[model samples]
Target chain A: EYPHVLLAHGGGGRLMHQLIDAIASTFASAELARRHDGAALRIGDMRLAFTTDAFVVQPLFFPGGDIGKLAVCGTVNDLAMCGARPLYLSVSFILEEGLSMETLGRVVASMQAAAHEAGVEIVTGDTKVVDRGKGDGIFISTAGIGVIEHDRPIGPEAVRPGDAVLLSGDIGRHGIAIMAVREGLAFETEITSDCAPLAAPVLKLLEAGVAVHCLRDLTRGGLAAALVEIAQTAGLHIQLDEAAIPVRPEVQSACELLGIDPLYVANEGRFVAFVPEAEAERALSILQTEPVSADARVIGHVTADGPAGLVTLRTAIGTTRVLDLLSGEQLPRIC
Target chain B: EYPHVLLAHGGGGRLMHQLIDAIASTFASAELARRHDGAALRIGDMRLAFTTDAFVVQPLFFPGGDIGKLAVCGTVNDLAMCGARPLYLSVSFILEEGLSMETLGRVVASMQAAAHEAGVEIVTGDTKVVDRGKGDGIFISTAGIGVIEHDRPIGPEAVRPGDAVLLSGDIGRHGIAIMAVREGLAFETEITSDCAPLAAPVLKLLEAGVAVHCLRDLTRGGLAAALVEIAQTAGLHIQLDEAAIPVRPEVQSACELLGIDPLYVANEGRFVAFVPEAEAERALSILQTEPVSADARVIGHVTADGPAGLVTLRTAIGTTRVLDLLSGEQLPRIC
Candidate 1:
């Protein structure tokens, strides 16, 4: 109704999807519509995965990581979700005029450490500056390229009715961590962001020949949003067991205090992997062995064909509720 | 001496170079120090070129194109300069809250048109929105990937002592066009920005088997910046013939009025190619045949080795002067 963009348009929820659709309508391509973590293409007999992300998290520095770490890991994980081994990253920074050199150095160091940990090189970058107040302190945008090593196609469209849904680790920590700092909450125990890179675990699945039908990182709109999107894309009902989903005690307590659902909060390092029922156990074991995903658990399964695109959560209290995409911006600039 | 970054840190001048060096020291990849338009890498059996640019051009709607057009073409041309056939681009947008949907739609339309003309696909993208006062109307950052089809390594390092420098077209048009609108200057005819994609002409040169040693697109900081950077990188001296460098009469008049050197003004559609002296005439002919480069001319030639990396201009009146990198910001957010 406003005919202008709102903060919700960047919320990674229903409105963001609609904006993408509107823009994609002007430049329609199947690759763009696939809505995978990245675009997979075959060029000159080589398979490549490409992805881009812009990070504008408020308060620049946070509990576990800063924008620089988020920028590299986000793009690297996107490529890994496509069954690609991230190789190179191109980082571009937009800095406000008066940003401190020391702050910039710290962020750059974080990026270097993240890239090194992910086994990817920061090969090229660009920098642009705007006058103070015209921009936030700094905004980092990264684009990543990786080689597709697995032969099987990976995405939501690959999700079948018989697939199992597995969660890499606990959710809602990242969102709560940011909110706590932004609102100046004093909790007994700090809820640090779980914002480590997920490429290693993802690559292990592909290397071990696990049939990962689809892999999506639980990011801006978190578990509910990711499940709902996959359900819509694959036209299958996603059934989640609320009792089995893992949530750290601090995160749950914070969510309760904040009147927000853990299922709808953003997470940085967590991912939901869809795999054939036959190999879900192997995938779980492999994921659990990874440092960043030690709490991996099977919390859901694809149940039936759903032209209606439904996601239902079976609460621990024996009540069933439908989970939909977050309607509006619950947390702006979370990532 | 300042503890914080100034606008000049992003001006594509000496300060920007120093900032890049400091950032590169953290990451520490030789490719980052090469400072070419893009970084070419070898992964498995495939050769790839990757690059990124953040477009913060003031007045998103310009004389010949908008930020969308620049976003696509700028990244594409960066890859093309590496002798790569540009294949795909990833675009990320940071939109200020309250940006009109109509404006976004127009920008998307321009991006689609430009991508089609350049024979590249916009395969993936990300969008994030910030508060209205915290951001400009819209800022676009694009990362491009292309396949290296040419066997010869192309970059500043490839420039040789006997290589001739060729200008793709007349200089100063793009920069002057922006300045005219920003400063409210009037001319006999409005100077349209020569902000077209340079990939076609560059690809043509590669496909025609031209022995191009190095190629660099003249973007921000213009021809002088490009040449000086190359000279310093290659540790060679470059001599330019002022009379041979093409500049439109109106552009000349505007530069004189503003007391700005045309050599240092930006040009989005122009490039400087270093090629063996024997093929300079052939290269000129091929470049001139392209509509975007019809005014191509042999402007100068590379001279002997020098640790000092000198660039001398032979004036029309037979006077010679050294050209150095612009020490401070002349125009910020030009691209």
Candidate 2:
């Protein structure tokens, strides 16, 4: 259902709501539809978590979702990554002048749909029309606030040397799909962008009481960047098994053809979880059963050895190499 | 002080707390220092107002303020314009790599100073570091949510014929200051950008129970665009005297040299308020007493007879010319 994103999907009214419900809801859950300007939740001892993110993904629409859905999911996931329960969101837009009203309506419908699926509300927003040549078709900035329950405190500081890294599903789908369309690279099989919201899986883990240390969405710079952040934040080293990582054949082929590294690619729907080694299998099984994480796997483990803040990958042939944070934008404006 | 933005300011830790206590609090109230992810105020019936904005001003640091200071004020002003008492703000930053730590600390300090000045707190934030070329230097996005009191909605929907327009202060300082800095036009006298937060003055008038119909921050596109929005929104024509609008001598000379219409210029700290004709004097008197609005004046009046959605300016030549919203940005990255 996704291809060229229409501007209407970014509008704050009814149509945007429909888009989230119909498309993005497939990957999200309830608690996002309240549409409050800020998520009003009760956290013990009066602590709340609020976060904001701006998504200016080029082409607006892609194989799986559009920017409107991505905007909502991005901020919600960011809050979830910080171990916060997702709540309310504020969506703001900068629309290029002359963008079709119908298109704008469609985008807004998608956003509203996404928010409803996530159980959040679009309580307040701002819309400004820019000159046609000044900006891309549209740029959407979403800011969300959530409440972090006192009992569920999780962060990079919670990481331990014996922690196991669990990744939800395949990597590089979002980036490869975007590249396929951008470079006009035809494939024997088409790969869709994995751009779904992931607030529920996190809450499920929190509810499971699985002693999860940290959670982060594997988006821009993909697994490599996400891993680097955890490593640096926790002052630890990580070793990932390349064979255990899931990558669809189409995405792998597309990256190979374009000389793109799959580890550095992007995936909107996937997340990396750092958990105690004892709960690794339980967490993997839980992720596997979820529709969004049918291909979830245990990719790595945090180790006390070697250079701190270094991320290494073990290849299929048993050779290990460093996976570094990308120094430059491999695909500009991809997100 | 001017420098590149940094990661710690968004960390919600000591640096973030310190930032608020610095520049952002220069014009703030005690209630703003709570620094929760979001502010929860008990307004009548629990009504709330939420707003977010991004400041992408060039040079980062300007004559009077930096992007950080501007971000806090622009968003606070938006909440005030909506007739809400601003409470909390979340600052998100897209920082380009290679930004020095020194520059970032300065911006954070300025943000702290400005947030304090505006009567708000930088409660939560997200920071993303892009590759060196992805952004100019650092782009800050601030999202604020406010709680509005009951019986205080001031919108274009409330504007009626015979309503009077009040100019909060001198118009062209912010616009002219930025222009001169951008064009490298030196002046015999230095003109500082009027980049101050204005919630104090607004709350003063609100408490006075003035019959204000609408309010707008004359930022981008200046007085002309703000009036045009009122005219279009209310479907009424507005007439004003050319001599009534205040402009500094340096601003006049800069506008003349650049051939840029001063009307289309941006002002970061000024606002235009539409009030009942009878209460106009009281409003002006209140405005004049505030430091931010020392030159406040009754600039024009709403008209029942004229082209709907049009604004006319009576020039020094004793003739009227229509003022329209300039389609193009008068000054790019002016904030």
Identify the leading candidate in terms of lDDT: 1
User: For every model shown, what is its TM-score relative to the native structure?
Assistant: 0.99, 0.70
Q: Which candidate should be chosen as best, given DockQ against the real structure? A: 1
- Each candidate's root-mean-square deviation in Å? 1.1, 12.4
Docking class of 2: incorrect
C-alpha RMSD in Å of predicted model 2 compared with the true structure: 12.4
Report iRMS values in order: 0.8, 14.7
Local distance difference test values of all predictions, in order: 0.91, 0.71
Candidate 1 per-residue C-alpha lDDT over B211-309 given as tens digits, one digit per residue, 9 for 90 to 100: 999999998888999999999999899999999998999999999998999999988889999999999888888887889988888888898853348
The positional error of residue B307 in candidate 1, measured at the CA in angstroms, is: 7.8
Predictions' DockQ, in order:
0.87, 0.09
lDDT of 1: 0.91
